[model samples]
Target: MLIKVNDRVEIIAGEYRSRPAKGADKVVQGKVLKVIPSTGKVVVEGVNKMYKHVKPSQRNPQGGRLIREAPIQMSNVMYVCNACGQRSRLGVKQLDSGVKVRFCKKCNADQGEIAPARKPAS
Candidate 1:
């Protein structure tokens, strides 16, 4: 998938249709936490939230609950344009280094920058 980790994307057509990951078009600013290309799903930052119960721990010591972003499928999301501020499909372009970058289809601007997945230091 062209979308990398940390890429900001939006939901296109679904119950979340027309709404970005944050429940509005303004959700583009959210970063991509994970990408599931095989399933066409992307875990957007601070979006698609779900609750989780945690066992008693030193920090909680009371087994509380927490909310987390659930994975939204790629088909349900699209890349947002920084220039036009619209959620649109992406166009692939080859750079000088032969690296393909996803571009905004609406405004034809280069957008959706993502970082390579990094491993935490041991």
Candidate 2:
């Protein structure tokens, strides 16, 4: 996946589309809270909110319904270009330092340095 934590994303599909009021033009832009590559999903901040019923516990003496962000399909989101300020596809380009970086396909502006690939556990 091209998205990482802290990356701004806009929901392009699903029921949560056009749900965020903080963004412009019904485009729900938010930071990526988590990325689940195993499930091909990403949890965006303030998107795909779900309510969970919980029992009273030590952690929550008055446990009731709690709203939380849920994972959404990776295909439903498009990366927001920092330069163009629009939802766009991401393109990978290698830097002179041998680091791979993500850039906006529309304006070809660098989004940010890509995180190093995760090493598989032994």
Candidate 3:
């Protein structure tokens, strides 16, 4: 719930665990990647993946195939600590600017800032 971008989260509530993630994955142990507050979904590096098929165009001319992606729910994962190399629950600390930062409960390291979201212009 307190996770941030670049926070290495662990699959505390998913089928994947104790293994290196596969698919378009990164943040194997760091960064939150993305957050979907409305749906409570969060994208972790190399976590969830789905395959897709595409029709071949002039580029392929063979009715080729393609794959797509989607983010998983944040509630399914927990932050991991750099010090202990283990998934840790988060602790909240309010800064002087009234900003809340995520701290690792196991090692007390800051999970860093959440990056600004990119959006398409209307």
Candidate 4:
């Protein structure tokens, strides 16, 4: 998956996309908290919130409804470009220096380096 943890993303589809209770802007965009490449899902911060009902336990003296983010399909989100402030697809490119980096497809802006330049094999 191209999307990485800490990357800002905007939900393009799914129930969370239209949740107004979180405010218009907040409902769409969030930082990626976890990436589940094996399952092709991602857990975004403040998105896909699910309430878990629990009984009081030693760990939690007063256990009740707890809100937590659930995993959403990765296809529902698009990477938010820091340079253009727009949601766009990402592409990987290797620079002349041999460093691999991600770029925004919309504005062609470099997001950041993914891998450092490596020395040529002797």
RMSD values, in order shown: 7.0, 4.9, 7.1, 2.9
lDDT of 2 by residue, 38-93 (tens): 99999998887777799999999999998878799999998888799999999998
* Model 1 root mean square deviation, Cα atoms: 7.0
Error at 16, model 2, angstroms: 1.8
Q: Write the per-residue lDDT of candidate 4 for residues 14-117, one digit (tens) a residue.
A: 87776633532356889999999899999999888877798999998899988878899999999999999999989999999999999999999998998899
Say which candidate scores most in TM-score.
4
Q: Please rank every candidate by lDDT, starting with the best.
A: 4, 2, 1, 3
- Clashes per candidate (backbone, < 3 Å): 2, 0, 9, 0
Reference-based lDDT, each prediction = 0.69, 0.83, 0.64, 0.89
Residue-wise C-alpha lDDT for candidate 1, range 1-122, written one tens digit per residue: 76778766765555544453443334434678998878878888866666679999999899978777778777666766667878767787766654556688888887644433344479
Model 1 scores what on Cα lDDT?
A: 0.69
Which residue pairs collide in model 4, if any? none
Model 3, C-alpha of 36: deviation from truth (Å): 0.8
Stretches off by above 4 angstroms in model 4 are 19-26, 54-59, 118-122
Winner on lDDT (1 vs 4):
4
